[model samples]
Target: MTPPTPAIVTQSAVRPLPRWALLLLCIAYVVPGFVGRDPWKSADVTAFGYMLELAQQRTPWLAPLLGGMAPETEGLLPYWLGAWAIQITPSWLLSPEMAVRVPFAALLVITLMATWYGVYYLARSPGAQPVAFAFGGEANPPDYARAIADGALLALIACLGLAQLSHEVTSYLVQLSCTALLFFAVAAMPHRTVAPAIALVVGMLGLTLAGAPALATLLGVGSVVLVVLAPGSSTDRRLPWTLALAAITVVAALVAWKLDLWRWRIVGANSGGKEWQSLARLLLWFGWPAWPLALWTLWRWRKQIFSRQGHRHLLLPLWFSAVSIAATLTTQPADRALLLGLPALAALAAFALPTLRRSVGALIDWFTLLFFTVSALAIWVIWIAMQTGVPAKPAANVAKLAPGFVPQFSALALVVALAATAGWCVLVWWRASRDRAPIWKSLVLPAGGAALGWVLLMTLWLPLLDYARSYGPQVRAVQAVLGADPGCVQTVGLSRAQVAALQYHGNLTLERAGLQDECNWLVADMESWPASERMVNAARWERMAVVPRPTDKNDHLLVFRRAAR
Candidate 1:
């Protein structure tokens, strides 16, 4: 008998995802949590407010220019999108919440699509496909596994960094999503054609629009190098030259627009030398829990780290991590740098997953279970303590304490804890069954855990932040005293946080007080209280209220108002 010919795989024979299904999956993966809470105090809302004002023609395009902050700092694209959203949405539908969030929501969806495409292309690259096929085996082709892996990556991106940044309405998410697309195009480019050049242009536009001209220039240079150095025909040689010139021109234009020649003054200068070490610690904190696994993977894969095939896929993540860390170390506020590393880490995590599945798979599952269980317990305990008014750190030798002092916890806490524990158990059992399999076992626990964590944060963590955002009931109490009198409320010696909270949540327009008639209410910190009261030429106002400072200092909110007429 003649040997059967190997099945000829045609394009139609390969199952491709339906367009509608893909669109729905993208949406499902990328939608931000609609908790309707503003937790960053005012940064996000204030930026949106300015954008809204500009849209309403109350401000000029040069409004941001007044401060010399580029419209591109947060990227011009999202702002333009937000501006259009405000202009088109009916006034009744245009609440501060809706105005800021809608554009981000749309971008969030785009981010998911970008991530999926990036990972798919990266996996389907010539270097990657054989390994994927070998890992999957003929009995089960790797296509479905590849899709699932990409989906998991997309899901993780949406759940963790992307979700938080987009919902919080920061510029980081926009930049991150753009960077992902850039990497996708770079990885997927076929040598000896205009395809790589097109990808480079798209990436360059994305970076320019996302507000990082300097970094974008670097990426453009890298792209040229990648194309020129790729093993291919002589025709491919000319492509890089053309791409480099185009990228350079775009970079120059963006630089000019951002006024790169100007020397920007540093605000809130930190002269202390402790910042360098603090930044390192902060990086660890931000990377938290995820970095350990990433480090472990790197050590395990040290041999493959610099291999020819691995190098292409590895370059982007490595560069991303290095640049972000360097930036954080050099910057005044290190927290902002945390956002830069998230995408790199997420990508690294995705690449690391298969390896994890092959080795110590059971251990990872068990550890994850333990982590969730401990996390749930800790959250519940904290919730209970907060509800019962039990001091987190009680004073020694204190006397009077209340009766029936049992701590109370929210039902949500118990539900989350149980769910986490159950999920962990399920994951552990599933992994155990497939311990010997070469196939990629579905590891949904990490993604599920992240999702659950986000829910907890939105519902529980945000409400706690409300205390800080509400100006410690200062705004509410002031309103009670003033009762809608125009110019009746003013703040004295307020911190930026206090002023911001007043502006965003209280719906008040505030300016510094020069004279008593400037406004009625005055808020002051302890040190500045005397100066503020003196500046306003007021003896004292009604003692409206007092609240503890939201942070870890023995601070109090002493709300004094000018006597009501």
Candidate 2:
């Protein structure tokens, strides 16, 4: 009753890629953003702020409080991990914020490794393997699977969304890593003996603690349903995954209960027209090349995907992607929510490889090569403009965008950019001239190019990005206005990010502005001036100055001084 698999691959089609090349690709993707940057605005600094606070023992670890307000995300483990990393880090080595990045960077690496192994295991399944040739010359199972796994990792690295968030020291990073681990565990369940069981329970529990209890539950339920409904597998073989799911459910409940992460955060209707449009854009660009291929896999493998057979190779990833898509629909900033699905998406994308024609692969290669070559050239040109001002336009754009920025030259940044460019050229040359036709060949350039762009940004444009994204300048400007030893600041209408910055960067104690609280200086956002005055009393406060982040003109930081009696 099961539909026959469409794959008809041969030995030549799935040659093993070099292991060293894969290692280099992963390093290129993982290492750049971890070093040499301040925590950029919004979530990055906000999360780092909480971690720094915990490291300083400023608040209870269970409920991290910043400027008398808890972080908006309802998760403790991520903050706890970052705080622990800070504590463990030797003071002689790096700043607490940078120290926290080390552990999360490891989590990113783990996510990549887990995704690779997951796809590898899934590809080893009987249905997933290519058809054996009549003369015994079909692609060797191990080599084919390894090649496909290689493609999956490349697909994951090539995704535009993975670069920034994967490097972040945040709860959601932990959530994403857990999702990848779940992918591995699910794929490895039938193949492995003990490791998959442990990974499943741990991954589910980790996801629950990392501010995504709903997503964790959905994943767990989906896995359970697939295993139960799968037609071919006997109950004995399915028992382990079922038990694993049940264990995940129980542990996840405990995590949600203990951590207080369970809350109704689904905002408004599931989606409106505007929301759908935003999501469409996110899906189109965020998943990029992977989305198109995943669609291809779903369409081309429809019989295998939907058939009653225990076609878990297709079913598992589809289930994961479907659940994540549903989760994305219901969440705000759907892109972040959609990030959880990417590892699965990448795996789905890899399956499209065996089915793709020679023409299609070459087309992909041509597009990737041209797109990334142009992109790398643009970054180099902008860097030159910023430094030497030969073109004048990029410099003008930089100045116009980030006011008060003084461009400083770094030989090391320049050297790294040059090396990345050189590596890109070599890669392109090899791809063009070489006669090799590995299944992962088309994706190699795309992943390498994505990594190249990120490394270039991190190295060459880090200062500009830091100035534009960081709250340091605004905080310092406020500090100057407040003067040395200015005492506690009473604040109103400030975002969590601003409050965190003031506490960490300015090193000033903050009191939430109110009618009863008395403080020498008050800081507030301009829009809330009337309410701030009403709360802290209009008669006692005098306006000092308005400070804005260099790039954003609309958002103003207002400072006030209290009058003497």
Candidate 3:
């Protein structure tokens, strides 16, 4: 038997958030990082490298390679999407770097939309609805569901980990978006059929193509089990849906097998004390604010969660979140694996709103207000230090961290940052002065504060971040040593990101170390200098210069010019 739900919400507390404000908040969150940033270090640039290779017609469509090294991730759809975006966009209108980001940005937007709808459907479940009052003042189901959905979205945006990874053009973001779609399909299955069925197929197939066939299969099978075990699921009503889901799951598995995309990458959990502590830290901060609320939801919904009534509104998200958390423990890149669980976590967090006491909500509001205000002030101070050197220590820290960086001021960026600051102030005022009756009021400061910090960093600290995180400055230093039109440069032991940086920023043609008969210059990683000597005739090549990446002194390159015979 199902226990009484803990929620006792009223009609007044379910007031809808304005549609315009929600749209504007989403736009503010989605647009900034995609627009004015370089393809950053490691994964971001490496993925962009593969996409650039495909766009330049230098790599096969089925298999992309950079400097003869294939991408480490087992997915090709992300690269295809980026390459397609680059190919279709005219260069005069948008550079390939900017064009590649457009689709990933859309994927993030879709993830947000799918998450909202998924939470709405879950909140509409009979078991999740608020209690009826003797006076008939209980919150209407639709209004309450919408209010819950609004809170879920705000929680997702406020997760600290989501800001950076979601903005990158990587397979992980694709997987995350597809996971949200699958989650929506499963949650909406009982009430709808056609659209949910279509979403299920697309979601499953998308997961297969996006390098997470295992996750797709697990989630699909789990949904089937939940449906069969659900109360009042007459065999007649359940069998057809079960069979259809099973068929789609089988087809998805077959597609993955045919494409040879299956990879067993489980790296098991690390038992080392420090590694465990690091992971613990990651979990704590990465899901901040949301994690605490999710825990609160579980506590309040404990009886419903464990009851025989099969309260799927809680069960489904718990399953999804559990699967992702399990993967995070066993995976190599733990953070990306954990990212797939966030939408479900946020959904779980939303359910806590109906049960939270006034004191608890006030505590959340006060903590968020204090935390983000200090963060914003710190960013502003650093920016001021970089511009005018008003505070000596922050400027000194910047110079020490990113050596040889020349700071430049942009009036446009400053105006945007100031405008965002003003908007944040207005939002704080609204939250502080207005009635706190709305269920989502508690999350307003957290979401707005998160957006404010992101905007400030993207506008105020963009140049500094680019200089520290990007390969542009390093590439330019190499070009300075090579002079104009250094043709057909041979490379040895260069990383995929370095090769891509050279091609994009230096515009230099590259050949393998032993393969370039006509090349006059060679660039080799300092660590691979021995291999360079073995590959080339040492007498014919003379050392030119050793160029170090400004941010990392240990990471330097050896430049060589072919000696005149």
Candidate 4:
């Protein structure tokens, strides 16, 4: 006998979150980080560099490179997308930096949409439906499913980790979006055929091209098994679809192999106690409220989860989440690996809403209110300190941390920040005073608060963050040292990001140190100097300046003026 579902909900509890509000929240979350920012640090800039290379026709499209080096992660599709965006966009409309981010922002939006639909379809499953009432006042299936899907979308936005990583122009975001598409495709299988089939193909192929061939293969294989064994699906009927999917999976793997994208990256065995502890900490904070809710969902829906007759609602998300968790444990970049699982985890979290007690919901609301309120307050206080220096400590701390940074006040930024803060206030009021009983009410504060903080940071703190995080300052310093027309500079031991920064910010022609070139200046990395020093004739070069990144004291670039000859 199938165990009874724990959800006991009336029509009132299934009240829909307003479409306008939901769309507004999504817009606020998706637009900020992508709009006005420099590509920060190792991953963002390195990826942008390849895109720029491709855009300028400086590197081969099939095999993108930066300063004669291939990308660290063998993903080609993201770079291609970015390059296409850059090439197609008019300079008057958007800068190359902003242009490259356009597609990625769309991907994040796609991830959100796919997650919502995935949860909606999963909730519509017969096993996942709320228990029917004898008196016949139960929530309508469509209404209940919509409410749950809204809650899942809110849960995804509420995840602390998604704000930053999803905004970056990297393969991870592509992989994440593709993963969500795959989740939706699988969940929507029983209802829709054409859309699901197209989604499956795109998702599998996207993952394979986005430096995650192994993950693509694993997810595809698992999904094929699920299709075959799905309780409601007949094996005979599903066989053709299963065979097609399996063949696509094999083709994806073969495509990866042909493109030379397969690389063995399993590094979990090397982790010690500290690494495990760090990963545990990451899980606790990164997944945030969603992780706890997912646990609750498993407990509440245990019977459905472990049923002999497979429950697609419980099993599909569980499989996706399990695979993501496994990848997180085994992969080199655990956070990016884990990002792929968030949509599934959010779906699981949404189901917990139907079973949550009023007290538990209240507790969640209160916690989110407190956490985000304090965080927003801190951001405002810091911005004030930066502008007026009324609070001396925060300003002093900023100066101490980011040496040589000049704080500039922007009226536009202030207006945007104030407006976002005011919107948050309105949202809080609507949640506390006007609205109650909606299943997604518990998550309103969390999602709103998250969007509030992100918008505030992107507006008020964007300049400071850009200075501290971006390599432009360092590159400018290097350029100042080089002066006008420092032609054909030779570079030794600079990382891909550093090279890209020089290329983009300084607009300098760079050649490798060993390359046959008549170059007047050579730049080298502080850390790589010792290894490369033996190859260069120290007598032939005079050290000019050690230009250091303002935020990092140890990261220095050594500029050398070739000895006058």
Candidate 5:
């Protein structure tokens, strides 16, 4: 027998957020950090380096390399996508940086779209729906689903973890997109639409191509089981798309293995005692508001959740979250692995909306209002201090952190920030005074506030962030030391960020310095002088110059010239 409905929502609570408002929020969230930002250090720069190589035909398509180092074994598809975007984009219309971002930006949008649709389908399930009123004034199932979907989307946007990573030009975003697509496919399995089947195929294949074959396999298998075992499932009784889903995943897994696409980062990246503690901390805060409500959803619906009927609604997201957490624990940097689960967390959070007591909802509203309002105020104050030197403290802190950062005023940016702030105010006022609002009302402010803060940062603090994160400052230092007509440089233990900077900013070709490789100059950190000596014929090369990044004393490059080789 089907479990009784766990939701206790009413018709009045199913009010839909305005379409225009939702559209504007998404535009505001996705557009920033895309324009006017250089590729940041570490993984972002390293990935861009490979993409540039592929686009310029400097590296073969099958194998990508950055500064002569092998391409990332875990992610080849993201590089290919970015490279193709760069090659196809017209140089006159957009810069190489901006051109590459076009597709990654779309991937983030795809992620959001999948999430909205995923929750829409899941919330439509019989077990997921709210109770019918005795007086015959209950919510329409479809309308209730739409309202919950809106809340899920807002929760996703408000997530602190998604702020920086979603905007980044990285493979992680591609994984996240596919994860959401898988969610959409699984959630919509019972519906009579071609969308779910197509999503199933694309989602499975996309995850494999994106260098997450293991997760793809797990999610695909779990989804099939989730569909087939769902009690009272209309699809389970008459049709068996679950088997089709299983078949699709099997093909995806085989294709990945056949192509040798699966990578092994878990071998040496296992978590230790401290690392486990750190992972726990990451899990607690990464998804923030979503995690708390997700826990609430599990507790409130614990009995129904494991039951056949409720499993349809709860387990799909739970499986996704479980696999993502597993991936997070196993991966070297957990953030990227953790990104794949945000959509699932948001979906689970959406279920908690109906069960929320009035007091609980009020508390959520008050906390979100205070938190975001304060954050927006701080961002505005910092921008003012940086621009006018009124308070002097925040400006001093900026100088201390990002020395030599000269803050500039942009009228357009300021206008955008002011508009978003105004929007937040209107949303707040509407929430506070209005008595009868939708179930999703509590989250509206938090989402808008998060977007407002992001806009402020991208506008007012972009320069300072670029100063700290970009390798331009050090790249300039390296070039200054090289003087004119510097020969090809052989690198000894140069990090990916440094290598990418030398290739992009300095337009210098780099190779590994070894007995087999012949080059005139060597570049590496001075601290590694002894190691650098081992790579080249030290007797034949003399010290050339030491170039130091002005802001960071430890960041200096030791250059060596071949002794008339």
Candidate 6:
């Protein structure tokens, strides 16, 4: 090297991922925390809050109250984990909100890793490396293309949904992660013997934990299909039968267990039902804004459906998407349904990336940038309107901020940064095209866009969102009024929403007032306070304080201290 660097050595100099690209992707993955308010009002959040309280008391094995009232719900796994996190983390370091969410964040990270691995395998199977590397003639495709694709996949994992899910603790998040892992495992299994065996074990575990076996059954069937459809010789034929038998046995066992478990019903327990319309609506909501691209990609690749390369990675995503949609449609809540499509959409979106032209790609990039930028600005505008003593005209306000609020300047910065990165990407593509190396250019735009999107979301978008949703002031108000003693306070006719907010932000425990004499203090909504006739005659309670509603009168906090005590 000292004598004179060889031509090959000079040409092979390593190129690192651009600093700005890395920063953007990291921001996107982590930034949801910024915009997302804590899990204050959500039913799942309330359930976890109760669980965390139980765990804080060292009752890690027990399921906490469902919906902060019902005791009959199953699946104490998330609760146990939350409890464990609470126990290990320092008291000051953990808010009840943060305690429950730690698991979500950890699982999200795992999902990202699984996604990378899955995409790597999928890319390899499709001869993505070979196709990407192939020059105009007999020359080999550049090695950098493979590295770039891998990086782009990683960037996709650090998406907007990941941030939102990680901020809100929910079983759906866990199920999504498990689902991704299951598919990854299935897709990676090449051999007949290993594939079914692995699918059986992983499939069982995932279905059991996900609280959805029908979907798991679909996944198992799809895996078998993949095996049958695989292009190998006679050996592949025997694989499907073996896998089918094993899957049947496992699924049958799971169904039996589920039936027996559901026989004795408690409050808040899910009773299976049919809701086809809701399912359709859920699917529509989940697919919005991004569904068009996903659908386009699938349509274009329809011919590849039966091809050997296409079938290899197809079954898992298809089964997962189909079953998840079906199951969510049948269930009561639709939000959870969004999670089922994440893996499929992400993978499908990745496939579409390679096909987009430079102009088209730039348009998509700009659209996302503009979407976030406008969103951020809208939030600030709303805040300004609210602050400047604007009359509360719900209809007018709705008309004005039709779509919704946007983040502040800090939030808008994410969009600006993305636009800049996209500009750079166009330049890179232009350079590559000039050199007659368009294939290499494919990797550049996607990689740059993904990286930029990630950064914008994580750093600017998340922080702004979190700040907007935080209930720190509300927590402070409660604490100032009520002393720190857990035994002194009680909540009366409190909604689960209020209970969750108090539990998460204020570290307050709420107990139902069985008798008027049971409580020293009562926190209740003025509108819903029980009639005086319902009070026990001997015990006296008087309203001592009222915290005026910050945002709405319906939310005023009326505090009653014992007149007798």
Q: Per-residue CA lDDT of candidate 5, range 401-519, in tens? A: 77777788888888888898888888888888856458898778778888888988898778777878888877776777777767788887787778888888888878888866667
Ranking by lDDT: 4, 3, 2, 5, 6, 1
Error of 1 at 37 (Å): 1.6
Native-to-model Cα distance after best TM-score fit, residue 519 in candidate 2, in Å: 2.7
TM-scores for every predicted model: 0.72, 0.96, 0.97, 0.98, 0.94, 0.70
How accurate locally, in lDDT, is each candidate?
A: 0.51, 0.86, 0.90, 0.91, 0.83, 0.52
lDDT of 2 by residue, 1-565 (tens): 6566667777887887778978987887898889988777889889988988899998998888987789888878899899999999898998888889898999999999999999998898877887767788778889888989999999999999899988888888899999998889888877786888878877898898888898888888888877776554668988867886877777897779777788987775444588678778888899888988999999888988766675878889888888778877887768788889999999999999888887888898899998988998898899889889968999999989998999889999889889888999989998888655677887888898998999899999999988988898889999999999988889988888888889888988898888777788999988877664557787888999999988888778999999877
Candidate number with greatest lDDT: 4
In candidate 2, which residue ranges exceed 4 Å CA deviation? 229-235, 269-272, 516-518, 532-534
Ordered by TM-score, highest first, the candidates read 4, 3, 2, 5, 1, 6
Tell me the tens digit of each residue's lDDT in model 3 across 93-156: 9999999999999999989999999999889888999999998999999999999999999999
Residue pairs in collision within model 1: 490-521, 492-523, 541-561
Q: Which candidate leads in TM-score?
A: 4
Task: Give the clashing residue pairs of candidate 4, or none.
Answer: none
Writing each residue's lDDT as its tens digit, candidate 4 over 69-126 gives 9999998999999999999999999999999999999999999999999999988888
- Give residue 140's error in model 6 in angstroms: 7.4
Residue 142 in candidate 2, Cα distance off native in Å: 1.1
How does residue 190 of candidate 4 score in lDDT? 77
Task: Please give the lDDT score for candidate 6.
Answer: 0.52
Error of 3 at 138 (Å): 0.6
Q: How far is candidate 6 from the true structure (C-alpha RMSD, Å)?
A: 8.8
Return the TM-score for candidate 3, rounded to 2 decimals. Answer: 0.97
lDDT of 3 at 222: 94
Of models 2 and 5, which has the larger lDDT?
2
